[model samples]
Each structure stands twice: as structure tokens, then as C-alpha cells.
Target chain A: MKLIYRHLGAIKIVALLAFMVFVCLPLVQMTLLAFVATLPHEELEVGQATLQNFSGILTDPNLRAAFGNSIAYVLINICITIPVALPAAYAFSRMSFVGDKSLFLAFIAFRITPPVVLTLPVFQLFSALGIVNSVFGIALAHCLFNLPISIWILQGFISAIPREMDETAFIDGYSRPRFIWSILIPQIRAGIAVAAFFCFMFSWVEVVFARILTTTNGKPISMAINALFGFQTDIGLVMAVTLASMAPGAVLLFAMRNHLSRGFRIGQV
Target chain B: MKTKDNSGWIFVLPAMAVLGLIGLIPLVTVVNYSFFEIFILSSRFWVGLEWYGELVGSARFWQSFARSSLFSMIILLIQIPLGIALALCIPRGRIWIGLSLVVVALPLLVPWNMIPTLWLSLLNPETGLLGRLGVVLGWPLDWKDSAVHTWVVIVMMDVWHWTSLVVILCYSALTTIPAAYYQAAAIDGATPWDVFRFIQLPRLQNVLLMAVLLRFMDSFMIYTEAFPINAGGPAEATLFLAVDLGEEIKAFNYGPSAARSVLYFLIIVTVAWLFTKAQGKLEEKAAP
Candidate 1:
């Protein structure tokens, strides 16, 4: 107890308090605003807390469909990103191909490519393909950018695992698919979890491409939340929608706060 | 180290192909469009760097560029050191460790758009804490109209939104340091300040560099929040490069927009490269 207090006494108290305030402020504001009725001038009425806002959002078919679209897109994004990413990660981690380093860098380069910049070309192409305003279109758009990051991060994790595992699996008569699914995967389970979480998070919260690609039927929660902006601002509904959109991520992060911190700490590598 | 399949390309080919068609191909198309003059349906001519020249010559583009750099710089100035300080404050063990991490991790889970909205209301003079306090203190604080205030709001919004990233990164890096090193520092009679300077700061170099680069890139490319608040209002004062490029894309001025994007891409790539190079040197010096 003396040892702990000696080192952490003053500094720990200050940091812990500040950090709690910092983390809690926005969330508390968001949660509170989402529940109450708006005052006359776009403000939350101090005494008007209710679950009516949640009911208002849930009952709206458009909001429901938007929720559906978001879920579908997130799932599709994970499916696309993980399968392709796993193989590409393995290749980059293990293979000696021409321009492998350059190719990997190129993938990293795409991760940094601004969606605002890429929006035009994708808009043009998807418009031509008649896939604009579709869930698949948004999924494709996300997968394009996110695939590289998945490879980069997953490659790092995959590389850290021993190669002998693969050899041993093969020698035990495991096929390539079986070896990967049975042996290689379990070794990098944490990596897969981290990578998949990020992939889902990015796809879930991504605005620009999702906005650009989907028109009505496939509109995501981010875009839908933006649509809450009426001429006379309904701060309550807007806050409710925004809070609803952010809830899953907030909950997930809270639940897996340690993993999330470690993932960020390690540079997602 | 999985070498059972030399045909790993077979697995990767599908993904690379899709990414190429959607991601890389469009970029190539953007580059191609930048170099050509296109008219309705049937007119195409080699413009040969004309769009690039126009982009460079435009005062608007330069203004937006300057704004972007300024925003990124201010965010870095505030977030990096603040993050380090916050990381330094947290107690290092399992119980408080879990609680401390959960505390810092909260801000990051909020979506980008909600951040500005929350602040916009929180600083509203009627019901907002900041706004009501400002009124009581007799300082007429208006976040929307004044350019300097807009900068403050944006900076605050960014700091609120992103500092968690830095804190988490630094804390993660800090936790990985072996306990014996710190114990040794203490045994050597190192003060808390001395231990942090000599040990913690050195260990944090790589993660700090990563934090800086991520923050710079994200802040520089900021669009959604800035657009919603002032909509680049009050004579384009808050019109960062993203807003300017957004306008071009909105107008369907494909040629010039593509050119500007290419230029933007090159500039960022250059800055990131230089940053990484400097970080490499720092990492070398800080090496144990």
C-alpha cells in the first residue's frame, strides 16, 4: 500500500478524475439530450426527460430501414474485409513476391486516401454501374479503403505468429483451408477480433461514402441522423437519432475497453 | 510464416481485383481526368497540365490549404502534450488500470458528427453550460459568426473528439514498459519528474509519432463537422481544403476537382514521409 501510494498518490488522482470527466461529458450530454423534449429555442428542457424520443425513432419505418441497411452493410463489410484480408495478410507476412513491399505500401496509401477525394470517381463509376443507392454499393466503397488497412494490421499480427504451426498442421494432413481455419486462425484470434472490430466500426460510422452511395433505401444511420435537420431544429429528435447511431459503438468500446486501448496502443499493427 | 501455399495470390487476387476496380482504378481515372479536357459526350482533348496550373493559381485553393495546415497544427499542439499529460496521470496496475482505461476510452466511441452537435448546443447561450457561463461572466461569446471563435470551437471539438486517441495510445505504450525499469529508476532516487523525462517520454516516442501522424491526417482531411456548423460561412473563413474540394465535387467540375485531389494527395504523402523519417531518427536516439 505504501509503495502504491508513494508513486501514484497525486498524479493518479488528478489523471483519473480528468479522464473520467473528459470521457463522460459528451456521453452524458448526448444521453440527456436524446431523452428530453426540446425547449422552444432548440434547447433541452431541464425537466422534460422521457423515453418518447426513442419511441419516436423506433416507430418510424424510414429509421427502421436505415437501421437495417446499416446492419446489412456492416455485416457485408466484415465478410468481405476478413476473407480477403486474411489471405492477403498471410501473403504479405510470408511470401516473397516482386513488389511485395511496394504493394503493401500501396495498400497503406489507399488507407490514407481521403474519401472526399475518392467520392467523385466512385460516384461516377457507381452511377454508371447503376449500383448507387444500394447497400452493396456502400459496402463495396468501404471494403475498397478498409481492405488495405485490414491487411496491414492483420499482416503484422499474422507475422508475429510462428510459421512452424502451419508446417505442423500440414504435416498432420490438414488441407490449406483446414490449416488456416483450424491452426493459423486460433493463433491470431486476438488480431482477428481487433481487425474485425475496427472494420465494423469504420464501416458503421463511415459517412462520406455511405452518404454518396446510398440515396433512400440504403441510407445509413449517419446519413439518416443528418436528415433530422429540419428548418426548425428539433434538438430532441436530432440528439435521439445521433445517440441511437452512436450507442452500439459506445457500448462495444465500454465492454472491450481494454482490447480497444491495446489495439490503439499498438498502432493497430 | 505459413508457407504451405505458394499460391497465396489465389486467395488475395479476388480482394486485390475488387480494390483495384473500385479504389485504385478510380484514382487512376481521376489522374486521367485531371489531364484531359472533356465536354458533353463527344469532346475530349489533351489539356496537358492546364488544370494543374489553374488549381495552383487559384487563391481559393491556397486559402483552403492554409486553413487545413493551420487546423492540423493547432490540433497537434493541443492534443499531443495533453494526451501525454493525461497518460502520465493514470495509475499503473490492474484494478485502477481497468477503470482508468474505461474512463479515457469513452470519448473515442462517440461518432464524429455528434461531437460538433453536442458542442454547438453546449456552447449555446440559452441552455448550454459554456454559453450561460459566458453570459454571466459578461463575455459575449458567439461560436458561429466570429472566425476566431469558429477556430476555437473547431479546435475544442477536435480536442474533445480525438485526445482520447492520443491518451489511449500513450497509455498503451506506457503500460508495456517493464516494471523493473521503473523500480530501478526509483531505486536510483529518480524523482517522478526525472523518471518520466528519462524513461516514460523515451518509451513513448514511437506511439507518440503514430498519434501525431494519425491526428494530422484526420484533422487535415476534416469535413463533416466544419461543414455543418458555419457551412464555411462569414466570407469563407473556415473553408478548409476539404470544404473547397467538396464544393468542386458538388459542382461536378470533374477535371479541376480531380487535379486538386491529386495535388492534395501528393502534399499529404510528402508530409507523412518526412514525418516518418524524423520519427525514425527520434526512435533511434531513444532506443534502449
Candidate 2:
């Protein structure tokens, strides 16, 4: 047993090293690309690093607006998804209605439905509504996907809370809205964080709907990166945009690190 | 027991309404379009089931399905075990565990399309580290033109991108296992394999199933990372289902695309249903 433990220690170190190298090497390279002025083979001295790539992205109105658009939609998506999911999640956790199971299953079904599959119809529908090329259109489309998962995750958290709290609040003359706002939400802060994290990650990274809906206007950072490859390729500039896109996620992950693993556990059950 | 009341409708109605406005409309429109040969929504001819019939016979459609299945299968085979092993290897010591988790999770935070961009730069033959290493080993990377290479690169990219989710799931599940379980196993002088079988595996089973559910669904429809790298190319080698659907939509093949999408949605829902059923079975089997 002692020998096995020793071997396991060595294995853990080796695995950790291998894992870091595998995961970080590419990111490190990409970061380096972002900082450098020119690719090595592209008529520039090796190690001639500069901050031009970052500045280049900010100065370009199109890329800057795209960065803004991506943030706007992601924020809009979380705003819509969480509020809509919360009440339904509360209902799911506390109350049972007719066809509740089937309706929930339908949500799971819709949640798994491929975004690509809905491209044509969603495009037609959105265009008819005159929301094509609009950030709000992207945000609304994202809600269709994000709301289900948001509900699923939030329901699990809400379920874990004892129903006795609700009774106590009511008995104490707490209004329903007051109870939810002051009691229910604070208790499920972690779950809300997790749900919002997912909604943010998915909506921020979502390319298909963002691509289809924002063809002529309101390109997100992803489209801006796409356009950066036209004619002459600026490798450094593209990597800068990619790195910028990851910032919100990185920030959120740091803030939610403690809640996330615990949140996933609740989600599984 | 939970409350059973009709008033639940009041709480759920908002979500249902929102979904109906956004979700049901497109869905109904898809079904509507599937029944017609649509051109620009204005020019249309009723062609009930024709597009579905065409899809049934289309070799390209079947090929994309096969590619997607294969890609998904490869992803599952790699990510699940790798994630589990990594999770187990995470030191139980508090500091080490936190550091391992955060480092492992870093890749997952990278946006989807950027994954390929990151990989492409890192695999650049002249400027990249791994590319240069490959040259030193006489196995220079060639994802640009070789179908086999493209498949390998994209599979590797997906694994790198998503394995963290599995790791996080498994790690969290591991943490839920009480410390006394290990102490008892040690008292019994249990081998590592025995301990894993009797304790860890049971706990891992659910999360692993979930990892499969998420990974399979996502990989089966992979497009964002893949399209940028090779655009489902080197002669359609990497053309997974979503990428194929993307091509059709880009071409404005509305009727066919709608029919194709309906079928695609059905496949995902069926797979998800199957997994959920299996999860139920597992729960039942475990229950006394």
C-alpha cells in the first residue's frame, strides 16, 4: 500500500505536468502571437515584440464595435435567461403541475436541438420581424437555448433548499416577491452564478446564430476575427481579438471558481 | 412530499410564453418550410415530403452523419478516460487540488472558434513549437491538406477544449465521496483497482454518463472550431453534420435545409432521450 501511494504521487506529478504542457502551450503561443508585431517568417526580426496588436484591435472601429456587440448580446442573454429561468425553476423545485414532466422534457429536447438546424427558419423568422443584424435579435435567439439549461441548473439548486423556508417567510408576512428577492436568490447565489456563467460562456462563444443573424450589421468579435483574415493575414491582430474574447470568461471563472464544482454536483442529481 | 398545484402554471407561464415566441415560431416555420420548396420565402412551391425523400437518398447527407458519429465517438473515447484519470491524479491536498483544477480549466474558458486559432498558430510549421518538434521527429504536421491529419488535429482540438468539463464533473463527484470510504478501504488492504471498482467507479458512473451526453451532442454537431481550421474541407473529410447544414444554409437551400435541420434535431433529441433513459435505468439498478 505504501509503495502504491508513492507511485501514485509520482504519477500525479507527471500527469499534472503533462496536463499543463498540453493545455497551456497553445495558449502561451497564442499570447506570444498577440504581443508580437509580425510573424517570424513575415519580414520581421524574431522576438520583435510590441503592443501594436492590442492597440490595433482597439483603434479599428469595426473590431471595437464587434467587441462591444459581443458583450452586449452576452449581457442581454444573461439578463433574459436568469429572470425567465428563476420563476420557472422555483415552480419546478417547489410545485408540480399537469404535464410539468413532459414540458420539462420538451425543454431538455429544445436545449439539445442543434443551433444549425434552426438557422434557416430562425433567420426567416427574425428577418420577418425585422430584427436581422440586430444585437437584440442575437440576445433573444440565445435565450431560446440558454433558458432551458438555466432552468435546469437553477432548479437543482432551488430543490436543495428546504421548503420550510418558504413557509416561514409566508408566516412571517413576507410577500412572495420579497421572499424570492431577499431569501430565495441569496441562498441560490452559487447556482445563479453557475447558470449565468454557462449562459455567458455559450452566448459569448456562440457563432452560428451570431453569424446568421448579424450578416450586415453588429458583427461580434468572432466575425471581426473572421474578417481579419481578408487579403493580407495579420496573425498577431487575430490572436489579440481571440485573447480579448476570452477575458470575460477568464474573469468570470476566477470569480466563480469556488461555486462551479459544487454547482456541477447539484446539476448531476 | 412536494406540493401538487395548478398554480405552478403561473410561475412557469413566463418561460413557456418566451419559448413559444422564440422557440415555437421557428419550429413551426421549419416544419412549414419542410413541406414546401421555398425560394426567398416569396417564391415557393408546395413539395410535401420531397426534401425528406431527397435527404433519405442523398449520399452526402449520409456521409456527413457518418462523419459526425465517428467524430463524436472518437471524442468520447479520448475525453472520458483521460478526464477520469486526470481527476483521480489530482492531489487531495488542498493547495494542489485548487491549482490543478484551475490550470486544467483554463482551456475550457477559451472561446470555441479561438480554439482552432490557438492550435493553428501553435502548429504552424515555421513558427510553432510543436511544428518544429514534429519536424525534429521527422513527422511534420500536415493538417492543411491531408484528410487523416485534419481529422486528427480537430479531434485533438476538441479533446483539449472540452476534457476539462469531464475533469471538473469527476473531480466534484470525487470530493463528495467521504474520507472514511478511503480509510475503510485502506483498513481492508484493498488494492487500488478494488477501491476504484467498489467506490470511485460507482460515483463516477453518473458524471461520466453526463460527460458523454454533453460531449456527444456537441461533438456530433461540431462546426465553429472545425470550419475555421479546414472549413469541412480537404474534400469534405471534416464536413460534420452542422458544417454540412451550414453549407446548405449558406447556399440558401431553405426547403432542403429545413428538412435536413428537422432530421438533425430529431437525431440529437433521440440521443439525449436514450441517455436519460439509461440514466434512469442506472438509478433503478442502484436502488434497493
> What is the alpha-carbon interface RMSD for each candidate?
3.4, 2.1
Clashing pairs in 2: none
Q: Model 2 segments beyond 4 Å from truth?
A: A1-6, A39-47, B93-95, B141-145, B180-189
Estimate the lDDT of model 1: 0.77
> Which pairs of residues collide in candidate 1?
none
lDDT of 1 by residue, B12-118 (tens): 68767878978887888888888877764257788989999998898878888898999999999999998998887777566676777666765665556666788
Q: What tens digits encode model 2's per-residue C-alpha lDDT throughout A1-269?
A: 66866697787779878987899889888898888877454456645888878888879999989989988988888888899899999888788788888888787667777788877778878888999998999999998879988888798788888999999999999976789899999999989989998898778878888888998998888888888886768888888888887887887887776667665554432
RMSD of each candidate relative to the true structure = 3.7, 2.6
On DockQ, the leading prediction is 2
Off by over 4 Å in 1: A1-8, A39-47, A94-98, A159-164, A170-177, A264-269, B1-15, B39-42, B93-95, B184-203, B283-288
Tens-place lDDT per residue, model 2, B89-115, is 887666667677777888876767678
